[model samples]
Target: MNTSLKLKLGLLVFLLVLSVVTIVPSFYSATPDWWKKYMAPEGLRLGLDLQGGMHLVLKVDLKKAEENSLELAANDLKDTLSEQSVSAIRTPSVSPDTVIFTLPNTSSIEQVKKLVAEDFPDIDTKIESQEGSFPRIILTLKDAKKDYIKKHSVDQSLEIIRNRIDQFGVAEPVIIRQGEDEIVIQLPGVKDPKRAMKLLGDTAQLEFKLVAEPAGLNLNELIEKAKKSGQWKDGEDLKKLNRALQNQLPSDTTISFEKEVDPQTKVERITPLLLENKTLMTGEMVKDAQVRIGGTFNEPYVSLDLTGRGGKVFGQLTEKNVGRRMAIVLDNNVRSAPVIRERILGGSAQISGTFTHEEASDLAIVLRVGALPAPVDIIQNMTVGASLGQDSINKGLTSGVFGTIMVIGF
Candidate 1:
């Protein structure tokens, strides 16, 4: 061959070799160690529709998020009233988008209205007439504000889910918001779909609250009351529990459960505990979290390191409430409530529960990524197995071989 022809042939051979090198990893699961070290490591990433994985459609509970917002607003109003020295005759009642409260006097109602107008711009306050002598006020979240919270909750949930998937070490995950309140997630090559689902579905909201010292109402009796009301079952119906305890609970206190399952009998037991409703800190203030083995039991647990502001607040909380029980709550379940022996000064804390290694790791991942703004329900879950993926690869390879032969012959 002439020099020019020889150069062209060499270039063609080089291009062919490069293409094969780039594509071989996708076909073979295991390559030579030297090849991995020397050659490019990345392979072609296929989607769930091609490579076979998990497909999930999660529906964001935007209405529940609105209720959560209302609850927070009600708490803030209570704090505002306390700060302004306006005594409330009753605890604020929070619905999905409204807060109802009764003031001691009509003079305090105007002050409360002014505070709501100045501090809570999203709430519309109305005087709902006097009950006997106390003035009743109802604060409803504005329609625009509710819509905004719902929209923002979806966006925040999407980001948090994406972060979690990325941390879970998926090569390439397809996470996108669908419509107004739905999220579509495609996880390729996930070996454990059930675990992945659990990780994704967890809201991971963490809170620190003080367990009420003088818990007046009996929690067991309260659980019986909840069961009689037909609103609670096996500690799952938190809203119903709240409703059942509405009249019995103290003004500043609420109830949550600590869930435990017996390994031998597989029976689930829930121990209810009274907790202060005011949240001293949240997972948003967490800087880092990791799974660690406990020294005494050798069991897996999560270690938390808080941010600067979180450290300050936590320190103050511990300092003021020395010898009091502080509850570590996750997704409304009380994980652990230990007495504050001394001020926890350095922002470090531990959450110990009956967790396997995998569960502890997943919890750390979610806490590190931060909590989802709202809860998500898995409306659709479909798992595609490796056999399906292999079939797809076989068909693709057959088509490619035929096309190559035709091109060469042509």
Candidate 2:
């Protein structure tokens, strides 16, 4: 061979070797340990349509999202009033589109109306029914505001779900808004469809609220009554129970369930707890969450780091609420209720519970990814089997090999 041809042949051999090295890992499940150290551990992955995986269509609960948005706006409005020294007769009560509250006098009502007009222009204030001498001011979200909330909610859920799936190690997940209030997700090569679904659909809304302990507020007795009466269904039991509890306990408090997993038997139990409706801090303030191994018995737990503002607020909350139990709630289920001993500063918190390492890791992933903007309801679920993928691979290889031989022979 000439010098140039020799160089070309050498380059071809080197290319073949490199290709073999890269392909071997993907070609075999039992790859050599040295290949992992020297080359990429994982090869280029096939997409869901090619490799077979789970396909899901989810609908965002826009109504529930709207109600949640209303509640948050109401809470913020209530805080603003307190900050401005404009006292409402009670905390702002939220409807689907309205925030209703009463002021003790015309002065307070005017202040609130002015505040809404100036700061909350998207909100329209109406002086409605009266409680004795006080006037009930209704704050309704504007059409434009409602539209924005709806759009932002779907977009927000899309991004949060994408982030979560990315953290879940899914290589090429197709997460897109399907329609006005629906999302489509295709997760490729997912062996555990149930776990993926849980990770994607779980709202993971985390809130820290003070445990409401009132005189004669027997939560156990209330739960017993609920159990005795099978009239309530569809998780509407919670709404009815809360309404009943409000007749006895403070309106600012509601009943929540604490999920406890027995370490020895690995059985799950739910215990009722009365928690303040006011959320002192939310998962929005969480800067990071990690799974840590610690404890007297060395258990896995999710530890949290908070933002600066969140840290300050948490410190203040713990300081003011010392000797009272603060409930760490996720998705309406209380994880732990620890009495504030002193000020828990440093923006750090540990969610210690009876959970396995995998569960703790998943918890950390969701917490780190932050809560979903809204909950998702699955409309369709399809599992793609691996046989199709194997068939595709076989056909592709046969065609490729046959074409290569034909080219060389011709």
Candidate 3:
């Protein structure tokens, strides 16, 4: 061969070898030990449709997040007025986007308007009504502010879900914000689709609240009353229970439930518990969390290590309420309510529940990463099986082979 021809042929052979080496792993499930040691370890990641996995579309509850934000703002307004020596006759009533409060006099109303204008510029205040001698003022969250909250909630949910998926060790996940309030996630080659779905769907909102002293009122009695009034059933839904006890619940307390499935009856039961709404700490201050087995029963539990500030705050909380019971709440469900049992320092805590190893691990993962900004509902869940995915691969390969053969013949 001529020298130029020889050089061209050698270059072509080298290129072909490199291409085959890079592409071989994609076709084969298990490569030779030598190949893995020398060649690139990564292969082409197939999509959910090709590899068979879980596809989910989640809708972010931006409205609830907005209402929560407004409620916090209303509480802050009340605190600010109290600090300014203008005491509101009653606690501010928070609606979808408005906070309504009654002041003792018109002077207090002017002071509130001035304070809100200066500090809470995103809220517009108006005279709502006059009750006896008190003037009720309404502080409506501005439209622009509400829109911002909704947009931010969606974006925050997307990031939190992405972080969770990354921690779950999905090789290549497709997590994207689909629309104004929807998130799309695709997990390829997920061995446990149900586990993945549960991990993705959990809101993981963790809170530490002091259990109400005297326990407010017996929620079972309230439930029974509702049942007698035809407002509840034997297994009443959470929304109906909340509505039934809305006025009966103490102003400073809220109601949550612990869910358990009877082993014998196989029926799910929710036991209601009254808890103070004031959160002493939240998962936002969590530094790290890990799954650990209890020394006694080998039961799985989540151990938490809080941030420096969190430790100080927690220490103070425990120290002040040494004899009280504090509830560990997740997603409005009371997981445990244990007596403070003296001051707990060092910022270390444990969450013990009826959890399997996998459940505990997933809980630790979410807590380590952080809670979702807003709750999410799975609007769509589609699982593709391995057999279907293999079929797809087979058809793609057959087509490719035929195309290659035709090209060679031509």
Candidate 4:
């Protein structure tokens, strides 16, 4: 052979050897200890059509999604009314479709109507009752918004799931909307499908609610009352405690507990806290969340970049509620309830905790995907074998190897 041809043959032989070394573990069930330690130990990952994998059919809770959206709107409406200096009070009972807050009088009625017309066009406003001087103004989501919510929920779920898979290093996942309120996902070559599902199907709700100060009691006193309650056995019956103290709590507030176990004693301590119904902000307001090494300790934290509107809202919330405890809530549990010492403006915030790099990265991913309130019911979850058959896959692999060999021979 000429010098150039000899060089080409050598290069081809090197590539073939490298391929064989890398793919050896995939072809054989058991690989040599030396090969595994020195060569590619992961082997080749086959596609869904070639290897067995997990398949899932998810049903989106459309109605629940609408309810969550309405809840958020009600909170925002309360904030807007407060901003406008409009006095209002909550009703005894509220429905998911309606926001019942007593306006001062008929004079404020027109202002609220005008506000809804201009600001919240998706909500239809009306006076449910004009008893006494104050009118009970009701705002319901329009049919158009109800329809939009269904569509929006599906789209949002798909985006969040895709973002999660991409972050966690899943390759070639087939995620698509199946129907009006369903999604079909085929995760190829996922060894631990349930773990992957847990990662993708987390419906954790993130909210910023002001820790409550009951009419006659402060936070300290509330915790004391909880500690002395009948449900304080072992400090685990949070629901029972809530039921025991529900009548004593102020309206539009609920108690949540955070559990901490002492490493030395192995004893658990339950810390009870009260949070209000109005969410000043939520994950939707977070434009992006990233893991960063900052602060005085140079530890890992999740840094949040808020949207323009969210920043303004957050600033106002902190400014108006100075000296009050604002809780960073996740799934109805308080992560941290810090005192709002100063009026924090700007669009940036930080979730500070003693977190390892992995924990912080996972939290960043969660925040980035946003808190998807719409719960997903896995209607179908099963492992599926290759539709193309093992024989076909082997044949395709053989064809590819042979084609490479033929090219090198030429």
TM-score of each: 0.92, 0.91, 0.84, 0.73
Residues 137-251 of candidate 4: C-alpha lDDT, one tens digit per residue: 8777889999988868899888888888788777788999998988898888778776677777778677888988756666556556767764454446555665556677787
Give all candidates' CA lDDT scores. Answer: 0.85, 0.83, 0.82, 0.79
Q: After aligning candidate 2 to the native by TM-score, how far in Å is the CA of 151 from where it should be?
A: 2.6
Error of 1 at 179 (Å): 1.7
Query: Could you list the CA RMSD of all candidates, in the order they appear?
Result: 2.5, 2.6, 3.6, 6.3
Separately for all candidates shown, the number of backbone clashes (residues 3 or more apart, or on different chains) is 0, 0, 0, 0
Comparing 1 with 4 on TM-score, the higher-scoring candidate is 1
Q: Using TM-score as the measure, what is the rank order of every candidate, best first?
A: 1, 2, 3, 4
Candidate 1, superposed: residue stretches over 4 Å from native: 89-95, 215-217, 225-231, 260-269
- Model 1: worst 10 consecutive residues (lDDT sum): 88-97
Local accuracy of candidate 2 as per-residue lDDT tens digits, 102-189: 7767767667877777777677778975546667887767788778878888999899889989988999788888879999999999
Number of the candidate with higher TM-score, 2 or 4: 2
